[model samples]
Target: MNKTNSFRKTIIIASLIFGMLFGAGNLIFPVHLGQLAGKNWLAASSGFLISSGLLPLMALIAISITHSHGIFELAKPIGKKYALIFLVLTHATLGPLFATPRTATVPYTIGIAPLLPGNMQKVGLLIFSAIFFGIVFFLSATEAKITDLIGKILNPVFLLLLFLIFFLAFSNPMGAAKDAAFTASYAHNAFTNGFLEGYNTMDCLAALAFGITVITSICSLGFKREKDVAITTVKSGMFGIFAIAIIYVCLIWLGATSLHDFKLSSNGGTALAQISHHYLGTAGDALIAALTTITCITTVMGLVVAFAQDFHKRFPKISYKTFLAINCLLSFIIANMGLDTIISWSTPVLMLLYPLAISLVILGILSPLYKNDPVVYKITTALTLIPALFDMINTLPEVLRSTPLIQAILSYAERYLPMFHLGFSWLTFSLAGLIIGLIIHFVKQFNYSAVED
Candidate 1:
């Protein structure tokens, strides 16, 4: 392709990536982080960007470098059984269990729920989600032009609307971000809190799930060589993630500054609603509603389609449409639990899955060094698994967490694990695992070479 054509194609791919990754959590979490981090928003944003922005970009690059077809293949070095388990868990989290459901509830929470009478909020969510998923099901079942639909059309509109909000917020300030008071959680370890908060975006997880589609999209654009595809993937992914990072910074800033006029919100969704209304009044509410709905629909459609297609491939006996129906129905049911409940429940799952996902991304990227050895993958994953389980147990619901068994386990972890209170006890374990795995792989390699000589 010529320079102009290549640039155009890169822009198109970048838009597709941005649309796929920038969904419910992407919109909400950073804003909430800003509210909590307050004067520490800049420091918090650095950690948030590392997890949410940098990790996702690395994941895409990892997928391209490994030349894996999907998450299953990206994880295959860990062994087939482990790969299958990881696949199921990853998809389940991204599908009906959390992300897909959040798509419906987030838009409802930010848009429609506020409009309804207090008692009517429950029924309103029910009606709105039903309608929302109905549309998702129909579009996914039909296998519509989802890429073009989102990239060429909806994403641009969403960005325009979002930037308008940003423009207004900056032009007519709610308050200065530096002067905003820090919340209790952020008062101590704001960066760590922000790092943990980035898990809410789930973009790292989504990058693995969505990586193949992005590669395939690049291939379809006439990039025949693997080298060319990887290069384009990096180029396009950088553009996309850079855009997302900017938005995250803006949203976090918005959250911090809004503290001048409003108290800290329960969640980012509420903060966003308040900010939008503050800037634009009733029209702002409508603008936010439209923006969220557009973004959410694009997201849910991608999730449902991905789930059905992946599951149908795994079980040929079941049809894609049947899986599609199952996903939408389940998501609709879960979404009615309300946004806060969904977020609360998702924390434990993300806690468990993120270490695995991050390790996998790192492993894939470094596979070239280890020559894709299974022993390394196995040992690293096994050690990481122990700390991940502990993290999940620690983050469980208050009732379950307060139980004797759970409390005892948590107490042990806190005493023994570094950074236990900071929600990153997994970092030390994961690093140790990686180093030990590499040492084992090299020792085995040295022994074999010596014997051969």
Candidate 2:
């Protein structure tokens, strides 16, 4: 019972968690928030932090606390078959469908797109990703020092360069904040926009998948006990939030200031690149590109490694090498898809998957506190998932609303739920409904399960 061990473990685990949470997408969301939030930066930042800062970190803490092996374990309390469905959906989300594809797309947009022609952009993405995952496969092949290279050296370097941009922005504001895009609804809308922007970050959902890797990394540093791992992850994760929040605040500020000088760019990368060009001159854009490419590469490496590791576990007969090859190939195909298409197509899937992902994250950290109750997990998941469906349908207004089944669900949600038009209102209702459902579900269970037969 060395209390000191827990403290030491927390620092180690958190440093590792920080590395996981801070990645390529961090560069994207804050800039957009700053642009759209314009004069309403604080209100928008509030919403941004809830989804970007607090929710994902909460989810990570939950994952470590519950000892979920993957997304599947957190969902397993509902039923094995249902958990499998959740597993496939979560895997597809972080894999080729959205997140994995974005790794290739975002870097190209920020790092290469401005330099290339419209027709050449897709070719650039395909080529960059091919090389990107190839390097990931090579680095992941060895489990020893290279992981440190990525988790430690390369990542810190990425943060440092980004921090320099933040520092410059801080010393000199880029421009004045403009009127927010939807000013009439800006106050309430900020939160919903923040929630959706959080999706673009994609780390929270990825956190669930990477949660166990974090636990193992903690144990490897020599904190073996489960209690120690929990304490360590929570503490370390808090430290990470502090560091990331600083960067987020800086980027948002940069975005807000830019409106003083120019109309907001249609794409977020444009806003970010503009900031770089103004502050540092011609070379700064290239400097930003170099850092971004590095960030994207490291993330792809980590994700592919995590995915391969999980696949091998499910099929023990297949060696890790084989799984690694399979992962790289799948990622390569998915990456070749044009950048604009990935960004456009990902919205529906991201909306559909987020609440479910959010639920797993919350359930994991809270599980240890709850004695891993199957009834509690089952009830809460069911409650949370209902609104996520609506969120998904609403993302595709023309296609989804036009469909019969979706029209039915959209009708039901709109008719019954107030503020349904507000972005992510469904997330709020579903989470609220879950809390309420759990209270009733657990009390009923206590009466029936706890009463002596």
Candidate 3:
């Protein structure tokens, strides 16, 4: 009986993790990558998996290994002020600012809009998003049952529908993959493009923010000890990562083979809908709609619950229910801004924030190598900030993108920063900072040991 309970708990937590990560990006991005990659689909999928798969798993593992209470704990080595800032920024990014809103917008665009008549599309979206976020608000307002609600109920329904679609697609493929030319970026460097594409999902950022929630869920499941919580977190995260990897590869395969019959699409969501319509007709369409809606709902609920809990802890007077209501309200308003606009505007923020989040995760994992020295964390994060800020500037809107100052900065970075053109200028700076940090750490250790002797 105890073994059975533990097994069930593992499955529940894993499903919850998968639901958190598998938003519209999981459903759409791999398919789009496969389409653009053409014959190089495998290479592209590998890159995508590295970013979307390995990076997120690493972030979760870092959380578990470090036993971080949350993003605040994860960033505390940098300092209290910076930790608060990082936590706020991460929460905002994963909450009302982008991820949560995108959940509502993505489903409306891909699932509902296509079904609506041209004249009714706008109204349809408003109605659909209203209902979507309404459900999110309802589910998240009461946080006690959230883990079970997502893991036991919503996730299984989502998986069943998703597996059905995948089975149909794989069993009777849309068509064979033809010798089509790769898209412009994919033609030269499909892998890197695919790698960066995963950033848009922002799952790594979500993982950092969700760390506390996962720990709480584990504790609620009777794993009260810190060590047990960490161990369970890693084990549960593995199940989610495994599910993501399988689904992504299959979706990419579906997209790659789709080129034989369907035209290349602007985004993965559209490609998925089109393919579904072609293969299963109305039933396929219903499946896609249900999948999008459920996936988006799960994501929104996860973020809403996380954000509410974090804020309520920080500001005890606010109450979790109020925080949940505020976030849902904000998400609903932003989501109604339309999917394309939200996505376009999100690019700059994602560019800037991704490096910082990645740097923290890497530092957390490597902290043991440097003996968990705060100096290492501080310097490495500072160095990472420079290139990430410049990258952010470069991704600005056209009006600000071509100014002389911005162009000059970009030019200078391109000339001196390794991998600047490939969107990893942070890599060179991080390594330099890590080395400097190690030197400082070892010198301090040596001096201390000599004095003791």
Candidate 4:
């Protein structure tokens, strides 16, 4: 490998990863955590790094090492039928069902909604999402050009504007890093709360989906071997991780320290708006609007391309353009549900999908130890689904929640399952399944050796 060429390819691939990973939610979630975590912001953000920064990085590495064509391939150890179901559900969640729509909503909520008159807010969002996703759809239609469009062009513009905002906010300071009162949610186990909060960004889930795109970009740059692809992916990911970490820390500090001089808003968007106004006035606000819009567009483009490419390959009857069109349209309609509605509805689904996604990634990393056994994957995932199902039901509305059947199941889980109250019941069951799987594997091996003798 030519050192100079490899370095250049790494920068571009890294920018592409950063662009895919850094969406509007990335902007909002950290700031919100900082504000809520208050004086404990440092502790809380340390937890946030686990889910947001670390897990996503690991997912990227796992995908590249597995040489997964997409999420389906990454999950193939679980068996074909299960892999298809996982791929469909994961892509749906990452695309129209949740993350994709949020891309349009976040920019509008933070950047555009505040600018519109109160009466026009609803109409403003509709028009904005339509136009926002329209541009995303157009860009994503030509999926092959994604690396250049995002990595070389759009990401540079976004970073320049973001850094300017960061510089201004730091130079003036929002207020002293005040000892803020912890919110009820973060009042206890603030670190864990922050860790959970990072889940809302869904970066770990998206990283797996986006990994195919990263691997393709690397191969395009001439890294053809599986080992080279994995190595280069990690090196490229370091660039994106550094950028995300610096930005997240800055945003969290901004939120944590803003309470002394600025009243906290209902959400991260409002808080960001107030801070921008305080520092840069209308000009600063405009810059924010531009930064958020660009970031969201790039993210949406990545998502649309990822979903379309994977689904199109799976179902050759449907063209990539057809799926891209469908995803873009669905995302536009869902996004118009408004930011609050989208967040509320998407939260439960995310809670359910996250544990499963994390389990698969971890299993993939540990595959070597188990010799990539299908039995291990099946047992672990099957066991995880029990608690994961209950977790989803717990997020349902009062009408469904009031059902005796639901209550009975939840009560049983809470009583029998360790860490149920803390939202990690799946961990216990998953571990048990792993142990069972190992025993079965070893016992079967012993029997086979005896037959051979």
* Most lDDT-accurate candidate: 1
TM-score of 2: 0.89
Candidate 1 similarity to native, TM-score: 0.97
lDDT scores of the candidates, listed in order: 0.89, 0.72, 0.85, 0.85
Give candidate 2's error at residue 251 in angstroms.
1.0
RMSD of each: 1.3, 3.0, 1.6, 1.7
Best by TM-score: 1
Candidate 1 residue 384 Cα shift, in angstroms, is 0.6
lDDT per residue, candidate 4, 1-453, as tens digits? 889988989988989999998989999888888889887888888888888998888888777666676789988988888889988988999899889999988888888877789999989999989888888888888778899999989999998988887888788885665577567777777888888888988999889898778887889889988888888898988888778988888989989888877766778887877777788889978987998899988888888898988888899999999999999999888888888888887777877888888888888877777778889888988998888887777776667778999899889978887887777788888888888887887788889999999
Separate clash counts for every candidate: 0, 6, 0, 0
To one decimal, what is the Cα RMSD in angstroms of model 2 from the true structure?
A: 3.0
True-structure lDDT of candidate 3: 0.85
User: Which regions in candidate 4 have their CA more than 4 angstroms from the true location?
Assistant: 397-405
Model 1 agreement with the true structure over 109-133: per-residue lDDT tens digits:
8988878999999999999999999
**lDDT of model number 4:** 0.85
Which 10-residue span in candidate 1 carries the lowest summed lDDT?
A: 138-147
lDDT of 4 at 432: 88
TM-score of each: 0.97, 0.89, 0.96, 0.95
lDDT of 2 by residue, 400-444 (tens): 568898788888878776666775555566667557756866787
Stretches off by above 4 angstroms in model 1 are 142-144
